[model samples]
Target chain A: MRRRLKSAVVAVPVAFVLASGCQKAAPPPPLASVVVASCAAIPAAPGDPAWDAVPEYVAVLIAQDLVEPRLLRLSTPEIRVRAVSDGSRMAFRLAWTDDTRDDLPGPAEFVDACAVQMPRVIEATVPAPQMGETGRPVDIVFWNAAWQATVDGRGDSIRDIHPYAAVDHYPFEAASLQPGSAPQQEMATRYAPARAVGNTMAGPRQSPVQDLSAEGPGTLSPVPDGHSTGAGRRTEAGWSVVIVRDLPQALTSQGDSQVAFAVWEGGHEEVGARKMRTAWIPLKLEVKP
Target chain B: MALAYNWQIGRSMSYWYPENRPKRQFAAVFDINKCIACQTCTLACKTTWTSGKGQEYMLWNNVESKPFGCYPLAWDLNLLQQLGAQQWRGKEYAGRTIFEAAEAGERVLGWRPADLDYAYPNVGEDDCTGRVDRGAALRAPHLNWFFYLARICNHCTYPACLASCPRGSIYKRPEDGIVLVDQSRCRGYRECVKACPYKKVFYNALTGTSEKCIACFPKIEQGLQPQCFVNCIGKIRLAGWLSPPERARADNPLDYLVHIRKVALPLLPQLGLEPNVYYIPPVHAPDEFLSQLFGPGVPAAICTYRKGPDDPDLAGLLGLFGSTDRVVPRWRREDDWVAALDEDGSQIVRVPLKEPVYIREAFDAQHQVTRTNCP
Candidate 1:
């Protein structure tokens, strides 16, 4: 009887071990790659479109500065990063070129003519993905070092201000044009009168040039008080505008004269003029008589 | 041991300009007449200096037409309108300028990101009417008149970019007077971009450094012209060195600059960025218009009186004024106009100007007309 009992204990322990072993372990899940979309598709970088919504977000840290975005040309072996869209997540790789911004000494500041690169990462988010689904891709971004910190208010120091503030802010009185006029007429009425009063030059037309280059030796004639006294001088070089006239609507449409008074008067020398002064406006005009 | 290595790196790092130091002296003289509207200067600059990821739009050097164009979207107009016209002198930029900023409390780095975006939009592109349609079809006359305006960093005697750099990343090279942004030291704050009235400084997203035109000193040192000057189809560009003191000279450079404007010659000087790029009045425009464009001094300067039926000055006019801006640099109105390197009181040393070999055409054009008469 004692021998039989010991054998039964051993058999019972063995059976318990076997039973536990028969239970199956969960199958290992599949590995997946992360994908990201472009900013156009998602407006924000992947992982969290609103991830940067918080002020503490790294992007906000960079974007807050009030500086114009510029390119940093570097000439070293760089990794090229092309931006690709995968919804909000975009994909990119670092690109390298031979350009560098390092300055070399000489009469002029010489810069190397090769492209450079910066490092960035790609991250994405999956709203309704199963446990191990592949997420969207993120677009590639590059680093620019020219960013300066932003200031909350207009700087107190004089140096931090623009020099031409006054002219830029010069007040403009909107012309209350006559009701239902043609687009051209409405524009002329709104701008022409104010311009005429501002230039302080006599005549219905504004001369294109101040001094007339004479084609022949003629005695200088004083213009009558209300009348402008110059004609188109045919210099061997070219024709110079001697008198400026603001022609009536009738003459301007005919295109008989070089001075298009009504048309020129339509635009004000306000903000547009300031922009004109700073930026390059490429305009080529030739008069065929 | 690590500290020692760091110290060694720091010691090796030296710079040409430092804060609170005396500013260096440098100047550039653009030959207004030589420029052609090919935009080779802009391309040369973009390819050589500003081509990078962030600087997709940045143009350290740009050519703009007068009377109707500007970069950074009318930078001067914004400020001018803010401050009504009033009495002012040099450096007395009243009211709000692009560089002006206010501190928010005691924050050491008054960092405000949103304000930066609006203050200076670099390389601000706008639609331009480059070629005006005076008429259309065979009967319609089209005037091909686009002015070439080559631009670069002004490196002002008193650089606004330097003054406004809160971290002091921007500096002017004392040796050659080139203003540069130190990318390594720069935290990408972009203060220089905001502060520069000319908006020459740009934020390069790739390097996070503000990039600008480097004056091509390497090529200059090698005794070669900058890419723009060398590649210019129209010999409109001249590269040379101008002494710094010229800015302080009692005879303002404008006297010479405006010389072209005074005789029905227009300079488009109202923006107040004090651009180094100047224009020699276009030949085809009328004198009264030119006078308006340039102001009132051209007629007197050119001796434009008619001598009977045969105009004497006509020949001189034709010779002096061509269909383009390729005028002799010396004849330009800058106070520092130097006839040659050896000339006394010359501000800038003249370098070799590689005139394009339109030798036959130029000679024929010059000879065809009387030396002083418009043919």
Candidate 2:
């Protein structure tokens, strides 16, 4: 009798599961869409009171495992996104939870970062979300925490990082050469080769955000004369950042488009292709009467 | 992926790009038996290239006592452990290379050293293998042994740093086969720093980019040896160009020692980077340990090195090391002397195979004084 009772107990759930399996599985819930609220002016800071009026769109992030040097683990699970546009400019606010704030790049350390990607040209069929497919380009606005710290008056000198470091002197600082002279500049360039070559990443930053374009994975390049502005603030929960860029041409006439997002946690040793990312989500512009 | 011939492994192996050899490869040979661990070469390289603000800890050239010493502590031990069993059959390596043993997503099997790993660059300096007893006396082939190993970027035929760079910023120069990181293009990803099996590539936090030994290309272009090679107090290093085995010319000093006599061997050939720098195995170290560190060529190399005195040609070639600051592309042994030749076959420098010796007369009649230290 006990055996029969046990069999009956197991058979009931099994039959129900089998009956449910026989029918077609329900489709997954649709991803959350973002609506860009029209504003008179775009706010440059994440903590601005003007951002409170915009609705939040929660984006679920997955591991970026599509290419070589992949992020097999997801450090950040999701992020809260908000967007605002004022005819000529667009600004996005992204907030996420993280316990450790990493902004310094040491020998073995990486910085926390985030980027927003959008298709350069809106077509009938959207480009592949893996940094966009070949022939179809994507515009990316990247913000780095270390760059933010630099913009906020944090020094990048070796002595600034290593307080106890002692050096006799750099050749560029020699008294023989006049300050800001051609010879002094040449000597300074010898020490900092990247800056001498005009590598934008190695130069002093005027803004924390960078404008980049990509055709596929590992093809990220800086867009010449790109003007983007951004600011980030640390809250009790984690990081909140605001990235401002030129409004896309498609959003003006199409009223609807797609956007993607990526986040990196410095404490997790994430950099380059190792990050948590989200696929394209529907974006709509609220039409004004 | 394409298969490239690695003579060290004695077989074609998988590489990221196809086989594209340079016009001529930069190569060097370090004679280990003569090294005195003076660290002069280290200082020479440091003061010349790595003295900048961001490169304080970077040693483009370093001399570490082997069996315990390593720059990024345990660099070889960690890679060997992860690579598992490395076997060999005669001259061919019967093992998987770093590229072959890579995981699904990675291009090479490697580990990134922590920041602290570089803190103690000379941790096990002068430490011997076996313990010395209370009354242990030194004898021939003494059990407790240690050798100083001087290292720099190998400028490998197939550089792991070049293969693993996602930005394609690190490149091997086609003219001289010297690998370098393009400063402007690097994004500080540090993939090269992590992928180099020898742990030679270093990351600069101040510049936010990776740097490594450029083999002193400016000097090389002028036909002068690198600072480290020229400044070696022990006269243990020789810089020259090396050709592939099929095209190796016996008149070339590097080819004569490496291909003809086989007196020097590449370090850890089983890892299969086909490193350009070769080391003549120490005579006193055990064969098993030496073979593991070098390759199956250790026994034959040691044998040939031991017979160096009897072989005048070999002896003359070794005497040419550290004889000049110029790069010797070709050489010839004429009678009692060896001549280093330039690329145009003109003699640059020459050294006698044996130093001229003189014994002072026990009694100098003219001075009327006796010599107390007569030989």
Candidate 3:
């Protein structure tokens, strides 16, 4: 509703021609690929000096052509990413501008999170960008701030987010007087398999990088040997997150693969399917000397 | 979501996932004829489950006087009335289920009850319709009739609450087939609250999440019955697991009562959720009223129940009501009786071959002499 046209706008391309005559600044290039430089040793953490070999890429908004478009959180347009590999392991550092630090998710709250996705099979006919196609699956290493807090030794207990929550009867706790005696509530401080029927509530697992394999939408399931991991920190203007994990099961040998990234802005109530992401980017591994 | 045949309702309804039988399901049956309208069961459930801060108005187990009562005001009276006008062909209820009514943005047969609807927990208690003159005698055929209808979540084989939740926070546990809310994942959208036609799911403002009856899973895990079933003073409630029609055994208490004897039927089977809670419709209630409430099965259920001593299965079925605190998983016919057995083959209860005759017989000389009145 608030706008100032500065001056009468000229019609069509003439406006751009005149604006170019003044020459303010050049627009950034479209995001295409993230170059993962093979390093002597992959950085175990984001701030490590060894990550400099990887070149930064401007991650533009994954918009216009979205398989499942969630008309929310389009504010954060471009993100900075750097990737590095050391033959056996891969890691990526992502930094995006976000004003608010949303680490704690309450009853109606959401938390900031990000994920890295790669085709389960190294190189095959392109799979659906939305997760993947059946038989042709995708490997995902997901990260969350809440889970990072847990990995940092400060348990992501419900009380940690909801300070006012007082629980007197948590029968599922390992420290309870009668633990393992009956079905129990999900305590913030502990993790217990949900007693919810069928496949409905199977999604509340709290591990940061619970490596998941998906073969299309709504078909995400946990995988064995999902040892993927990550850590996240909040900067003044945004968050700097680094995710590290060995190549997924299918990519055991050196070959060309595909990688994708998705970012969730918690301040905008973005969770689940309502986030931003890329379709797929080419990822190549160099041959051994 | 896809359309699948719900054999219990003998129709199709939208389901979010494929159907697979639980190894064991938590189920219950309530005999409305024997309910004394006591609040004991309600109190027992309240003290056990929904007595938390935001649960001031929550009654996970409520026994309301029907035809004139509902806790969330009318609950589903509007929906029932809407569904009532729908056509039924033979045993089929030809109408749109909540899933078919998807254009309206709800997956099941439901409507959002206004907040004011929940303001009063007891809206119509012991209310009757007709007003008679002071001198007029109370006629044999009363015009107004109401019955105590106790309710809890059905933990349905196909749950609308489970399908309605966009977040998929509601789930039915395969371990015991007890439907529950995962508080951690619930964003408090109230989709489950709106979609449960029974209006059993409640929204907790303090926790900013929805809550419902957990079926007393702790006690169930310990091989005990729920507090509501254990504390019923009228001895009219039976808690057990039901089997698919093909698998139901003649001796299992629930199987005999529901499938073999055909005396108990699921409430509103025409809605097609394949509800787990079954009810023995009040025998004296008008056929039209009972039929509408229990679906086309009423006449058969009542007829089977009234077959009396002639029907070999009647006594064993009738005797199982309120017989034990734990559900009998299986049964064995022992001569003239039925021994209800658990998973370990332990007898949980025994049903006699004949119904007990509590009336004083006119042929008895002691009764005739004591009364001093004979035909």
- Which candidate leads the pack in DockQ? 2
| lDDT string, candidate 1, A117-160, tens digits | 11111122221110111232111111111110111122321122
Chain A, candidate 3, TM-score of 0.73
Write the number of the candidate with greater TM-score, choosing between 1 and 3. 3
Q: TM-scores for all candidates?
A: 0.37, 0.90, 0.60
Ranking by TM-score: 2, 3, 1
Q: Evaluate residue B153 in candidate 2 and report its C-alpha lDDT on the 0 to 100 scale.
A: 98
Ranking by DockQ: 2, 3, 1
lDDT, candidate 3, B42-82, per-residue tens: 99997666544445567899988866678878876776765
Q: Given candidate 2, what's the lDDT at residue B81?
A: 96
Q: Lowest lDDT 10-mer window, candidate 2 chain A?
A: A23-32
Query: For model 2, which pairs clash?
Result: none
Candidate 1 whole-model C-alpha lDDT, 0 to 1:
0.33
* Model 3 per-residue lDDT tens digits across residues A92-119: 8988888887766443345687888888
Best by lDDT: 2
lDDT of 2 at B84: 98
